[model samples]
Target: MTVAADAPPLRRPTRLAYGFGSVADGIKSAAFSTYLLLYFNQVLGVKASVVSTAIALTLLVDAVVDPLIGRMSDLTRSKYGRRHPYIFAAAVPAAFFFGMTWFPPAGLSDFAMGVWIFGFAAFARASMSMYQVPANALGSELTQDYAERSRIYGLRYWFAYAGTFAFAAFALKFFFVATPEYPKGQLNPAGYVPFAITAASLIFISILVCGWGTRSRIPYIRQADEREASPGLLSHFKEMGVAFKNRGFLTVFGFAILKWTAIGLYGATSLYFGTYVYQLSSGQLALLTLDSFVAVCIALPLAPKVTKWFGKRNTSLWMALIGITLGTSPLWLTYFDLFFPPGHPLLLPTLLLIGAVYGTMVALSLMMTAAMLADVVEDDAVTSGKHNAGIYFAASSFATQCASGLGILAAGFVLETSQFPGGVDPALVTEAMTDSLIAHYVPMVMGLWAIGCLIIWFYPIDEAKHLANVERLRAREAEAKARDMQDAPLGAPAR
Candidate 1:
């Protein structure tokens, strides 16, 4: 009878543990999201197509496996806690696999290299899932208060920024800039060392934090009895079909997919603008990252209040519209050549504008995404006979990964098509490069397909419906629990 409101707010230590898990996930995921394609293409000497195929194949297989993992994690049991044990167990292997992913051997065929890359990447991804699904499920069931979930998720995103800053500011430069032996002119796969070390070090520390830090908030749920569940693969498929056929759930999933894809494509292409077009050096990239880090702090505290004032739907819509404006301010600079000389002093103004606006949206949108997911889960439990927050989160996770994988593919292809050689002088800004970069940025910035994001974001799952749905869902689940109890002792005494 742990009603959502009746459950006390998470303790300080528990919140810290949850924050650690969020930070760890952010750190581990940051490398994959931001640097994987670049690492494989430039540092490890893999072709763009090869990197794309490897990532795409890994994700395709995982698309199915990840959902199953979420369901299994939901069904898991242990004294340590249902979710915590898998999280703790996955840490070491995740670290190992993340490192091995970047360790390319010499003189291997592209096919073998692709196989090796896919294997390690898949292992690392699956390992993260062990911790992430349960943690997300734990988030929903932690409290019933709508505003409180936003606060927890918002704080988690704050630390999530810490990871974002760490990976963004250092990981690439550390790979392409540091490593004493590789020096400045080296082109052999020797560049892999610094990248591997960086990935290994960050993910290892993240694993430790998430694994050890989260042990205390060990909320566990009992597995459903075997007799009451889908008894075969055919039944499982039927259940899955029913789950997807729920139009409301499908709407939420669509928004999540589009949102993450937009974010993912942006991540994969950032280096292009920095390195190829504006021709910023490692130092400049670090500064830009610092800009984003600071902006995240400014926007974090305000997100909850904004949601409260506007409600989740309008809050998200306004943020997106404003974000589209602010985020695309850089596109306005594409017109700078008309008003000022190519070497105009106002050049710095455009750069600063891009950095500032980029930072704002980066921070403001954190809780908007989290709140939408909360609504989606609430709707699911209300409409379906059972609650499956883990599966819904897994669906989001899969979409994000797929989007990221395709983006890696597209980014690699774009850079290769542009024929921008790597390890070239970082300061050589060129007109051709600027034109190409602007070509890509203008569409995304001008909110071309962003209209699609709007359509998906506005699906009918508003706050009132979510609240009503939760009440109904909770009643049904409680009744089902009562019936189970009555049936359990059919021929025996109650424990």
Candidate 2:
């Protein structure tokens, strides 16, 4: 009987370095979802529909650009390797464009403002894709071990949340500080430029540090030429079509679409909810950022174990179910007057506790989904004879972007329908407006997340199936090498 072996665990530094790259993405996502809509509509006086339209246009462009970036990364051949060159090239431009979004020229019409937003946001998304898709594909390649992938991804998510927590805590406390003139700091326009500068600087630093830290692994990773034949331009879409034929990737992609849409909706609304619904001050809201820290603590240690015990699919499904339930519970509980009311001393702490637990669930779900997606690289390779980790991850990334686009649109719809006033004092907002906003927001978010949970049930691979696929690929490799040896001329110096 033969005992099976798994890949050795990645070194802690290697894992941490790779994980650090996620900080850029984390900050960007936090900005887009949490602050972008709020700033444009509430501070800059752009219509909600206009802001959503601008962002939606950016996503439409991303829908095309993301996959092309992925395929190009897969086929790229160079001394620095497939992913790093893009990572290095994109860092500055991504930061520059992102920073520019917050500093639009004054006195532009709504149409002009929309154009400005679409242009800068498009460039920023594309530039980030240059780094993110390839970097995520790199994570997939860092190890093939079934369980260890979970750990690596767990660390990636941990760093992401850490970055998010750090930024939120600092921005709310320092940059968006309440003043006599602008008591609700989030609605203040003066703070946005400084916020953009700090965030842009961090984005630049994290991408470079990740690139440098992961440099040593380049030689060990499979080079582009070592991959199967590169597809022609016409065949690129064909390549993507074939990739989705794999059931595991398709199901995960489906789930990610819904999951991210829900996330985007929540992000877009959280500020409104906190400011008007809960009547929380910026200082009190800063305290809520602690939820992310607590989530990191809970998720980093818990993800691998739950994934191992429950399997990735089950872990993801349960986490999504629980997360959405708890995440949205405060709304329902408050509606029935069964929970803390606004200005209740216990309300903020109760929310913090709920957010911490909800954040943990979301972190676990995200980590498991990435690990599950990584596993499909081998399974798809076995069937298609092509190693296209970049395309697979890119498709997932596009789904996330596309869904978030829709989520943002939904947020705008909610605001428009609810008659939620923009560029006004939160104290001036009426209870009826907030109640109407919740009526629209909660149902839409819950529905998207629930559907996502249903789709994830269809993911077909588990540890046993993953290990089998690995062994089968290894066997084919051995047989191919044997045939090459047999076919070589006698004393040909091993060809």
Candidate 3:
């Protein structure tokens, strides 16, 4: 049975606090997707394959660890609660290791630099997983209302994008300013020092804020039974198997894998397109940060309303399709020379508008998926006699890491195949190189998006089914409570 639903609806301050925690995740994500490869490969002269390999390897290893952390969060009992302790403890090291990734010593060989990136990246991924897995699981615990979960996750994504914009804008505006000596500000080495420090500080602060802000939720959170047997390795796998057996979980899980891979691919390639294909300067690229800003503005209020109109599964599928179409349109248009040429006054503005819409659709899809994950918690609980939110979320996180890793690795392969010369000026890039990059990128990303869109059709839950599942769970809990009272000693309180 699920935990008591007596806790009051979350107030505005609490929701804001809860949403604010995702800022750390946002910063870390933006850093990895937007700047990490460029910094190492373009700035430091390490090969793109080497940097991508370092990132991909760490993510692959971390994917394996996510479930263990999720299972441990499920079992652990502490004064502060199962999720928060890990949440709090992860803050410092996560920031420290993330910061270290940007500060590799100068004059190192490419091999040595890759090793450095691999080592620091491993620690960074591990440390963040400590925070991310439990933090994600915590969202399912905070509320059980299906619609409310969507709203809560909408806010979560809102803050996530806000953090992304903040970090990206800051780096682009202040640190990565273009000069005569360095035409592409992103490739400037001196800027990385302050950028790392600022990012680390923000990561540390945001995580602690999330932990502190959500402490009130601990009392309302479901905890592991003190008397329940400790699960062994086989049991953990068995439990994970049970979670995946639910058709809803399986479908959403599959969709998340594909969706995130597309996202990772977009993140890995967007800068290259902006810098080379579009021939945008650093300041012009900085303006594109508004895309996320516009997305957050629209998504926060729009996602739940749209979900209410169309239902979660359908809304998610439609949004994914829309996002994929809009996001890829510019690339295809440019490829065919059907859109504004480089230096056209409308080029940047048109791209920005398209990005804004694309970002919103992606945000909506993610919110629906997260809400669906929470729904699966009860659906699994109905048959299995256990509520394993941790395992469900962990599996999703595992898919994310593995799929995103593959996407990043695939991006490396694309660059290698395109023979896009590293450590070269954007001005020196030729139309043939840009065309090869686009030709390789467009079809692969579209195929992944299409596959992901189709996977949503397999999800079994809708509003009615979800409500029915809630009723069944509540009825079961009532029976258990009555039986405990009947069996209790006369005049004693029942548990």
Top TM-score prediction, candidate number: 3
After TM-score superposition, what is the CA distance of residue 149 in candidate 1 from its true location, in Å? 1.2
Off by over 4 Å in 2: 1-9, 226-231, 480-495
Write down the lDDT that model 3 would get: 0.84
Per-candidate total of colliding backbone pairs: 0, 0, 0
Ranking by TM-score: 3, 2, 1
* Strongest candidate by lDDT: 2
Predicted structure 2: lDDT = 0.86
Per-model TM values vs. the true structure:
0.84, 0.95, 0.96
Residue 120's C-alpha lDDT in candidate 1? 88
Q: For candidate 2, which ten residues in a row score worst on lDDT?
A: 1-10
Over the stretch 18-57, how does candidate 1's per-residue lDDT look in tens digits?
7656665666556675667666665665676777678767
RMSD in Å for model 2: 3.2
Tens digits of per-residue lDDT, candidate 2, 15-98, equal 899999988988888888789999999998899999988887888888888898888888777677788898899899999999
What are the per-model C-alpha RMSD values against the true structure? 4.0, 3.2, 1.7
Clashes of 2: 0
Which sequence of candidate numbers ranks them by lDDT, best first? Answer: 2, 3, 1
